[model samples]
Target: MIRTTATLLLLALPLAFTRPAAAQETPIAYTVAFPNAVHHEARIQVTFAQLPAGPLQVRMSRSSPGRYALHEFAKNVYDVQATDSKGNALSVNKPDPYGWDVTGHDGTVVFTYTLFGDRTDGTYAGIDKRHAHLNMPATLAFARGLEQRPAEVKFELPAGWQVASQLRPDATKGTWYAPNMQYLMDSPTSLGPQQTRSWQEQDRTIEMQVLHDGTEAELDSYVGLTKKVVKEAAAVFGELPEYDFGRYTFIANYLPQTSGDGMEHRNSTSLTSSRPLRGPAALDNLGTVSHEFFHSWNVERIRPQDLEPFDFERANMSSNLWFAEGFTQYYGELLLRRAGVYTDAEYCTEALSGIVDAMLTMPGPKRYSPVYMSQQAPFVDAAAAIDPNNRSNTYLSYYYIGAGNALALDLQLRQNYKTDLDTYMRAVWQQHGKTQRNYAPAQPYTLRDLQRVLGEVAKDTAFAGQFFRQHIMGHELHKYDALLAPAGLLVRPARPGQSTLAARLQYNPDSTATLGTTLLGSPLYVAGLDREDVLLKVEGQKPISAKEMQKRLAAHKPGDVVPIEYRTRNGVRTAQVTLQQDNTLEVVPMPNATRKQLAFRKAWLAGKAK
Candidate 1:
């Protein structure tokens, strides 16, 4: 998945099943109907045939691929019933919150349930009069001990609705096929009145299927931009992955009812957004398209060993998301720049600046390594909770940390090794990603394998080992200013002389201000101020608004001490805090760039497509 959450776009081609069903086993069959779609409900049934046991265990998925969190998909299921092959009522037992155990099945059990979903994003299902957006794990129930069996699904669609999915199309109309449970769960489906465009790339079909409220002209313009993005993304890898079925699809929903998300699958991506593709937002939406398409190589194939064989029963965690997700983050924007969707200045100020600033200013990266940050995804990647967490102070997203690392590494490789990130990516691709085994990578990489590959790419094992030890496994950052100098870019403070308390203040109508999460080393934290503390005065003057607070702080310089009064849970108190300079940074072009610098920058940013 490209975002924290998690598409079905498909192109049909002549291809053999990646995993063929055994002679003795029967395919698990599923039927889905949106009879109550107007009420956001789906009727789903699964038939497990040739069951050998006295009891059959059936369950909903607790986790999704690409998303590291547990989503508890079973909560949306209701009115579950079971029956034997002869249509007799079977005994259904509730063994746990996630599934049911059925007895008296007579070697076959047909399980039925009602699923209600309103959200239209990667992790959940959405059904309406307009369409049915299905993320399989959130829509289907699977039987245990039958995971290796082939799976077939048929959707009973409303009039004029077409199916868009990566799942293999069966000979029967509205039916799709998956060789096994893993592939079935990874495939998302969108059934609606959709507009589709197809093109050939490397003799493989590339498709774009859109469910939108926009005009045909708007869709046409978006497809043009998508073509540029797809071409540039393939340039980074030198070639696209050998997509299963010899095709890849981009399934997008650009409707007001859709939520903003992008999820990558083996051969397709699910893109949902409320933003219309007719204005600047169209380009913004393309950023996600760029990100997810890059994942076809980086994540779907060059996978983390920890995430291979994704567990649908619980949270899936990985220590290499920084590289898996973050490097893709770096390239996502970079590809846009390469495709001319964004100019040099736009890339630097809009994309690079944020990445560099976040790594430098955020306390999380200073306190924890990229590996540690990646491990926190299960808690932060759309995982819901009631209690408050100090993630603002202690946790930085692996996405940002990894992009920062990728930026530094890319520059380091260019400067020190006479190679660049694109070269390194190709190396990783050749070693771990190029070969596919059924639905997964033939050689899923480990942390050590990544380090070894870096060493090989750089042609210096010592430097690679040192680089990993410092920036990846250890909490250390590269000198950005020096590294970016060769390309005529400068990393400098956004506000050079401004003094700040470094705490977000939410001003209340009652003439007081409440603090957001204070940074670990900020002035507020040093003065023992934390989240939910109400500020009454700064330097003995009551600041009524954020502007007033800033006006008061502008009177002082960095290192100046000021008295503040605030109300904590214990009561009101006063403390003296020493202010610090605003450390927010930005990357900008040098004023007098040399010819060599210009050449280097152009070579790095220009499109690599042939």
Candidate 2:
């Protein structure tokens, strides 16, 4: 059997490439066809010159970058077979967790599997080749003995289907080749009919690819947001140099079942949503689009070292996701403002809306310790906890809490200098945002790097640079209402009067369980209880009255231990947890803050030029 030398991309930092780039030349072809819907299940065949040459071994990737999870795409591979050049049977064996060996074969190894392309979210294989989402979550099977880069994949088209992923150059007759491993890995391809549209603005040309089920006319109106996005993100980078820069937006529509989220790729992004692109859908479309668009700068080009040349086997975690996601969170909203697409009232209302959610979530300082949040993300992601007592321990999403941090910091900076966040905002991109390709080659930014950069801008502001440690790094939230009140702004919380329990208490997510655990220091938490712990009965009374429950719990002083039964992952456990007061952030209407604080709040928000 013959195997080819591997090739790579210049500046492609992470991949391990083989020497000489390209050597042997046999045809390698793979065809992923969707016979029914968007789900994919297909077979792959590799043809070389020999009978069991003892030269090839294959393995699948553990996961992909950007998306933070371990999704073993190769789990679906089945019914593998090998044959000699003359079509004789050869022996094959499973060598490791994700590795397979074809020993008694000299020519070809054919792998067939029924890929479950059930959902449109994440990655999936689907029907008609015309309606499939490309490469995401699909197996990145590697020839173990060969370097990770410089490999090839040939496509066996069904005559009517067109190749969709980024793989190029079809070999002599039957094989569709990837040429290099970098191309095989990063360049995503699709196999089906793609709906597309193009429009030009100034020096940039904007094009969008819509992966559809043939009914796509409804999206024609949604293309308008792309121009707005291009303009806004370009402004953040200072300019959208047409000749030097360009971006391609991909809209992957699973029509009836849309994921409603946009994930950014290097040059394109993948999105799934059921909302109509024009009317009410436009609002959500703008948001998801804006977020992913911002990633073009924050993640795609200007990113953390771990992100670039990323490890596909597992997640690349960084505390800086707060910077990557939060700043983009801040900007996703700012883009609307910068484009004049959102009125001041709209922008302010949007900003106000988030504070309410964050407050209810009450994510505190401990959420993301300075040590590592991203590294522990898979285990601690929001999905894992059905109910949490102190969401702070859960490390509220950077999208929400972190965004709040950005707003809060911006307000503090503006209040200090009577200026706005944009002043220091531009500093992030210029001093730290997008400078080069890979972060490892250059100096990586630390939390201190961020502190120094923002500190220099806040030199004269009312806030001290050390405040970043207090609020940003420390997760301390101040009563921002006082700061905003002076500017005729007031955000009052809906009242939660202490009343009797009218209903059995249970977590919103896990109604089946009772007496859920509240975080330490949480009013309910400090009162003694942990998450997943059921309050079988309040004070031993089943269906206890709200009044009685409140009276009993409220009457207890901090450090009072209360009996409780909880079913932990291990088994049923009972304990008396001490009640304690929590240090949750509060946002009472601060109509009484000093004039300077109010000015800072308004200016910082207003100054954000998107």
Candidate 3:
């Protein structure tokens, strides 16, 4: 049965009852309680074994692991009070935006603060009567220089509520242990009544803990689908990552009250969405499961130097997130298709339209390369508030470009070298990720490291160097038409001779409209039409909608001049634009393919060397 919020809360036991600490290990202990979930507030108590010699500074993270943005988590904390082991009050000062400095604390220091969490996603914490979704970095505070210190966390849950996390269980009930602060902050905990399913994958355990409005039967089916994905994904790398804790957990909250997010960690992933476990929502959210699970190898342990020992004081920027996140995006879809969750037609449609078509048609890559997009992640990756920029015209998600590169590289290897991307990725895993090596910031894989691995896989350094130069370091997009020809696939225009408006259209019911991207080199660009230009009219009549504007433009052939009116900072204006044919592409199978084409296609899809 799906447990209701009131039922979950009724399960909570009183705070007067305390659990015993781990045997002789008095690690930094944290107690979290949700007394009034309706207020979206949580009471957190932190106890340290001893105080530092000087002023003790405790801080909330500015950035969390696996995220690139600076969240400034301290903003949500209130009613903070610090005291000694005797409960004597201590003086606390807010010296900075991210931390508090406590002084005059003898021997032991215990602090309590109320944290507000209204959003339920991978990056932030959220607590209500129904459940508590904890992203440790956002909900817990760590001492300034004791990141290596062991810690224990205990939840004062509503009666009958259970907990799901990646952290190992301690001796006490409702308590977990982390070897150090890094692990503590990296471990996210989900609390509530949940339907759980578990299976053993060889030596490692795979578990799913789900809290949703859906039924247990739905959750059971989803778990079965998840097992398929895990198997297929493991086949790509030829092995599973060393699950650090000997278990990998998928902690998901699909309640209507939760916000949507998917985040990866060393041994687990947190997936929260408003979507359910059945129907189309299942497919929609499973991609996140596949993607984050793949990350157990890619970013979690394979590691990026800049992101290592993740910075909590500021944004964690990395130029390799293009490869880190983007390649995973490619595998997310591919693995799903391989697992039979997606049919061939479904796979082809999404790849051609969503990833390929979007990347090829967007003007952002024409201006900025994939590496630049990866660098821009600090501002773009989930950094959505207070943004006023016209990013549509200037930025393409790194995931799109990265996935496109993966496609191009995969095809090129198959065509020229009788190899594929799987071989290259596996080689990387064996060398960098397999050793369970904790990468140092100074030792992260550079572009050269990637090129070297590709060269090794293809046995052709020249091709690897050139591919990296053109697609990774430079902005040259692949011509997929040539890349897919050998695999019995053809790229063609979705609509023949259809004229493009060039500028992306956002229209209101009142006929007011705004432009999103006036793509460069298109008719709109040649005609001086730009982003943020409010569409006042077209040929003296206000555009009723995007379809109306498209219909009007479709009436003319290429080279036909049309009058366009728009508003900008300079006020009303008019321009004569020459209509151009839309170049949006789609991939279609060659019904009558030659034997060689079919052979190449089979080898590519089978992930086998030619």
Candidate 4:
């Protein structure tokens, strides 16, 4: 049986009972009220009934789903209290920072707390007079042992407000349903006076609910653009996943108070941005829309085994995010081009070239493979730390590394294997992602599974093995120039003759330059200069700004060793640093191309919305 919300509720009822079976069948219910919303607070109550004859451990999740970092969500909860079925106060023990242990409950426990939230984004909860945006883990507390119990939530919304969420709507007004803890935690809710637009595609409802400070007409135009993006993304996968609720939703919050972020969930996506629905900002916002919707097929369902049962207690790391997130990152922009939202030049210069440049120029990918980089997501993926990190030298985002791999593999597949990435993705979908078992993938994939699928798609195990070893596991980049030639694209240096120190500098008011992390093998690093070192002079001349520094470097040619003076924590230092030619690369169309090249380029970039 497919665990739809209704079916799961029915199945869950039989497991709980102490009073009459009818009364005992009551699911775990929560009631949320926002009387103190002006103060960015919400009063939340959760009732666990038909207990198993022991103390119930009620706790707040330390981590949210899709977010790899531990957010310590319990810190925001205060004024915690618990009561029994007769409303008598129970003993609540603060055994740890994350949770409370409640004893002396009369077969039922009602746990309540005041949650304070102010940030509006995908990972945390935001509450105000304007709206209450709730990412479940950041808002709700759950009983430890009752993970399998069905759950229902009721929102006591203020007047003139409505609720929008992926949770199943119940017959009772203001209530929504989830099958189990996994589904409940994955569901994010927005309660506000928001504008909504919905359409049907292949008999499945696709809805866009936006909480924005814009007119209805502007939203209508944005929705039109969004529809095109939706069409292009669906074309890549051939069809949308069969949504668990027979619907898919895009819950967007674009307001002055919102922070920019995109989070993917089963059957929906949370898109929050401070940009409005107008002009270039609108297009930029749609970029996130394209990315997050594509994730509906990739990360949300095309699951990685390491993240299969997402642990809410600690950080979740994976070795397959390159394919999961990186491939999606590649398609996010490609689909925009396919939808005609971006011209060929715009895509090549802005999106495609950026990926190539980071992979080729950045030292991180040269040192760490995509698999190793993917494992670092817990620390780098929005993780907070007071200590400085050497990420510039040791790390490149898996998003970029994976996208680079996707680009190389796509070009190689087209040239040698007589196929494309779309075909391989569909094959992976058929093998690993298409089957749904409750709230997650029935068959989540591993690194080995991905390699196997690639072998199947290419019809050659040897090529797949070599590609995975060189790119995915081993730190080796592809010959991009050769791979892009068939499509009449050239990977060439952006500034070939320009000389550089290759270190980012923050010009100070005191006529000194503070160096950021100097890249490995750069002139600054070779001269024993690192981050926070103040550059007193270069070539015996003080350069006050970045432009001035560039002008000074322009006077000399590459390989010219010039005297430099800098100050470090110990004392002043003097060294001779050799200037290096700029190695930044870009992807551009060849001026003169054969008809075959044009055709190949068109075949690759043209819309495939049928």
Q: Which candidate ranks first by lDDT, i.e. highest? A: 1
Question: What's the lDDT of the predicted structure labeled candidate 2?
Answer: 0.52
- For each candidate in turn, the TM-score is 0.96, 0.73, 0.92, 0.95
lDDT values for all models = 0.87, 0.52, 0.79, 0.85
The C-alpha stretches of model 1 lying farther than 4 A from their native spots are 1-24, 171-173
Candidate maximizing TM-score = 1
**Weakest 10 consecutive residues, lDDT, candidate 2?**
1-10
Lowest lDDT sum, 10 consecutive residues, model 1, at: 5-14
The residue pairs found clashing in candidate 4 are: none
lDDT (tens digit, per residue) of candidate 2 on 426-541: 66566654454321223345666677766577764235455656655565555666555555456653323322222235533332346443543454454444555555443444
- For 45-159, candidate 1 gives per-residue lDDT tens digits of 9999988978999999998877888899999999999999889999999899999999988898999999999999988999999998898889999987777777889999899
- Residue 441 in candidate 2, Cα distance off native in Å: 7.9
Cα lDDT tens digits for candidate 3, 1-610: 0000000000001123212332344688899989888889999999976556777898998887777778889999999999989999999999988889988888677989999998888888888888989999899988875665668889888986899998898765658988666677778899999788999886789999889998888888899889988987888888887676789999999999897778887778888889999998898788889888888888776766556556677887788877888888888888877777876567778664567787778778877888899899779777757756867768888788888898888898878887888989999887766764321122346678888999999998998888888888899988888998898888888888887667777887879688776666888778887777888888889988877777887788877887888898798989987888888878877889899998887666643211
Please tell me which model should have the higher TM-score, number 3 or number 4.
4
Which residue ranges in model 4 land beyond 4 Å of their true spot?
1-25
By TM-score rank, best first, the candidates go 1, 4, 3, 2
Q: What TM-score quantifies how close candidate 1 is to the native fold?
A: 0.96
**Candidate 4 whole-model C-alpha lDDT, 0 to 1:** 0.85
Q: Rank the candidates by lDDT, best first.
A: 1, 4, 3, 2
Residue 344 C-alpha lDDT in model 2: 55
